[model samples]
Target: MSKKVIELDALEQINLDAAGIDIGAESIYVAVPPGRDTESVKEFPTFTADLQRTAEWLKKCKISTVAMESTGVLWVPIYEILEHHGFEVFLVNTYHLKNVQGRKTDVLDCQWIQQLHTYGLLKASFRPPEEIVEIRGYVRHRDTLVKYRSAHIQHMQKALNLMNLKLVNVLSDITGVTGMKIIRAIIDGERDPYVLANFRNKLCKKDEEEIAKSLEGYYRPEQVFVLKQSVEQYDFYEKQIQEVDQQLESLYKKYDPPDEDNYKNRKKHKPRKNQAHFDLGDSLYRMAGVDLTKIDGVDALIAQKVLSEIGTDMSKWPTVKHFTSWLKLCPNNKVTGGKVIQTGTQKTKNRATTALRIAAFSLSHNNKSALGSFYRRIKARNGPSEAITATAHKIAKIIYFMLRDKTDYYDLGENYYQEKFREILIKKLHKQAANFGYYLEPYNMAIPLVS
Candidate 1:
């Protein structure tokens, strides 16, 4: 007897007006529905004029929406141009387009994307407003510049080490005011350790005698040349970073501030280890409409990074859970046969996640903050990695609430979280006892127990 085969159900099309484009470095292959008085697939050069023409062709075809894989920075220009042309462009991640598996080519890929989008199977990645996008670009470029400056500092340290100088040992920051002055003097042929030590400021914590001892090194001419060049490059990058900071401040001021006079009565917070060149704390608070720097372990620099990753608009994420998931901070649970299999957070290169993790690491040094207490508690049970992820997750939730509600984060205190955690443990114990047909009562530690 012949076996009967069951056919798969067809997906209903929800977006009949959708189009798709397969983006490449030099060309883009766009696909629209067949028999729409337009070629089903057409290849266009990856140029501004070509992109404009493609947008115009889509408009002529009455296409209202488009979906394309985020191949690279190549998609950015087309995305913006299509957006300008009033097309609802969906920038889907490459991973999300793997549902239709088979022999893949340029034409096939574009056709597949068009079909999937027509059935409403594609999800667009979160993108901020155009203004925020511009600000993000500036913020990221500044971060790169700072990294370059740090590399130059390392080069200076290497040069100093070659000369047997222990400046890094005595001075916490070798690029600080006093250290730079001493280094400059050394380059100018001041070889006396006492003279270099005299350049130290009274505010510096290191004693003059120790600094003098540390400054005494076998100064070779080549190493001195290297050090001078390193310092000059570092200074150049510093000026560039300052210009970027000025741009950031100007752009941030364009946002509507919650209170025009709030800056007048604002108390200056403690400076960060590497604070921005501008008044980032006040500017971030005004732009975010909340004082994010008030959160435990968050400083002005961290707040700026967070705001750059995700703008002040919280509506981009529907809920806090969605935001955390997008950051890859939440656990991905796999279940089979109604049994749990695996639960672990998916790794991601998200900047917000990295910034939150850095903040979580800083929390380990603060023993009194609520987040610090929570981190210690989790660390005791799950070790350091889990503790960091948990703490970062908590921070992501706190940020979400602050941005969504336009409210400041009020510290609840470590004791409050601990007390609530104790209550939860007691409730779990009671539930377990009742499952075994027994009753459990709250234990009073203040009262003596009678046998």
Candidate 2:
């Protein structure tokens, strides 16, 4: 009963005595044969220290292939270390190993993982090279900083509102040329909203003298200070965002990943141009459905975050649902006797999912999008949380096709679903009516098949 679940029979030519190591934040537990199953599990400090020493110990034990669970982002360093030691490392999902009651422990986890590795029941999770990972990290960090800045801006806006400043009523963006000038003056101790209004762009139709006169307002000194601080923080984050953009430009040039123009360019263009199209290590930017800007509020940083979280090799998945399920975006099922079931969605949503949801929320207001329509559809049916997830799932599927197939994406337009809406409604109605004994005749009156 114990046999290898081989993917390719050709791989039968290769020798395997694969080991498994369950890595935890606190420690690492490795499993091997010819030792007390659970007792032989070797524990090591989960740090950069003694990485070489660990490799040496593994070498002495003659361990070749290794498998480990993906424990958040912590698994990366260990994976890199293991890979450097000339061992075939398989980064796997925890879901693959179903631990029963009274059968789970650090040692047992390692043993179970090892058994899978030996039997080839494990598949390596998609991992781009270190440079791509580095690129992704920078991009994701930049997005976090952007969100932080936006939050600060919102807080500042609330402070301004509480101060009875009607500046927002007059100006489109408080950070705009005229508004900033007026805000700066106020923060620098000017007590008048009228003065801020007067700071509007020279092109403003509002009379400056009259605006300045109306800007007068009673504002708390403490509130002004808090607003000023928030504005200053927001500015600081803005500066950081620009710096991150500069950093991203370099990564974009480095790993262009596959896409429509990229593939065509690769085939038609020379090596010099091809180098420009894909990353030196791996071209993640060029992957399928890599809009890099499709989801609402997803800038370069967010684009990098989504692509980096799940690489472009979608063929590894049977479908977009499979990919999303792997990301733990779907329900985890517990079934008995194939009749009754306990089902609930994944308790932990991924970081990428959070980022996507945030972007989807921002997209709700964007009328220039298929994404907006998708958002509205889900939001109408469920709630904001489910809507966000639905949009994110749609995005994930899009990304899967875009990267894996190296295709181009264009928004189908907001009316896309609407255009086909009647057809969809009719089909659903037909199904329901059929069960209720209300048969629907074909619009064209059923034509006989010309067999």
Candidate 3:
């Protein structure tokens, strides 16, 4: 038997001017295409000056593009530096670099990344425009503060429990006006249940007498101290959140069109529960050039979140399919022998995707919007979870069209959509009858008068 020899095909280098870096906290490993320089692979210390020097070195080597893994927060500074230095930076997810088979090292990873990028095999992750990124940072920090406030609320509840106070049981929100007033009075040495009940808000569902009974507890000094601190911390976070909202509003004004009257005639969407305290609807409408909140199930907060993650530039995605794929709302099809073996959506940490899913879930209880009808139709066959994902995917497509066209969403009501679908079903039924050599006609039940 003759030994067989196999030839490996070489991939054409499409980006001859590309370079890649294996970034780290303490140092970075940089690589360029072969023969680019005497020292193709070099290590640079992780410092501002060193990063500048690295950029200078890449420029000297005639490198125009740079690729790097999304290595935690370490890649951010270098990415900005490279971007500032007029180099196109591709921040690739680490998962894409995993398919390169070899003994992996920092040096090898840079080489592999450079090789892959040269062949245009890697894709850069979607990052919103720079201005939106700044707003995103503030919004994300505000979310943390809000979560921290919730933790304090839980702490207050625990302290009340330890002191045998049933305030939470009587009040819907322990952080609301009534609960806070009673808690402040308790911490201020007002031990009488009747006096604490006197501070309850009139709108609270529980009667003042019943609230007085709930407030009666063996109040211990230690738990009371904890309760006081919790309330103070919650109050501090609330003030901080207020400041963040102000900052967001101010930042948002930068994009407000000089002619606010353009949106004055636009239909106003009802504010969502726990929506941002500021008037984000008008700003978002102006910025997006469309009112996304008009879409059923999409509230002001969710609209803001989706826009922040995706920006107002729908041009980044050429089509609705591409947009949904990037959002990880579409199915990832794996085929074997020309048959699909697995079909599932890519699991993502994208906040926009999460917000869309939540919005879709909310539509499960609604029967008015076309989207809600579609959700129920899907939910009938698949479970609620799959229905939510599918409905969110549809919403993603609607959003793509609305943003790309800069047009307001005009929903065809659920009744209209269902009627159209019913017509299509009737046509299909007629075709089936014809195939069986039978004619089909509309049936009406009416009796002729026998006068």
Q: Who wins the lDDT comparison? A: 1
RMSD to the hidden true structure, all candidates: 3.6, 8.4, 4.2
Distance from true location, Cα of 153 in model 2, Å: 3.7
Tell me model 2's lDDT, rounded to 2 decimals.
Answer: 0.68
Report the C-alpha lDDT of model 3 over 1-451, residue by residue, as the tens digit.
3757899888887999999899988999999987889989999999999999999999999999999999889999999999999999999988877766656775688988888899999899888889999888887888789899889989999999998999988998877788888888888899999999998887999998999999888989999999999999989998999898898888888875624565666666665435677888877776788888888888878888888889888999988999999999998999987799999998999999999999899899855989999899889989898999999999999899988987778789899889988999999999999999998977656855468
Instruction: Candidate 1: list runs displaced more than 4 Å.
Output: 1-9, 260-268, 434-451
lDDT of 1 by residue, 1-451 (tens): 3757989888899999999999999899989998875578889998899999999989888899999999868999999999998999999988877865656776678888998899999999988889889988998998899899999999999999999999999999988888899989988999999989999998899999999999888999999999999999999999999899889989989977757565554446687545777778778877888888778888888888888889988998888999999999999999997777999999898888999999898889756878999999999999999999999999999999999998767778899989999999999988999999999876899999899
What TM-score against the true fold does each predicted structure earn?
A: 0.93, 0.70, 0.92
Please give, for residues 205-293, the per-residue lDDT of candidate 2 as tens digits: 56776566545666789878888898889889877877776675665665445555534433121122102212322233443334545
Question: lDDT of all the models against the reference?
Answer: 0.89, 0.68, 0.88
Worst 10 residues of 1 by lDDT: 260-269
- Against the true structure, whose TM-score is highest? 1
Please list the residue runs of candidate 3 whose C-alpha ends up more than 4 Å from where it truly belongs after superposition.
1-10, 258-262, 265-274, 447-451
Candidate 1, pairs of clashing residues: none
Q: Number of backbone collisions per candidate, in order?
A: 0, 14, 0
In terms of TM-score, which candidate is stronger, 2 or 3? Answer: 3
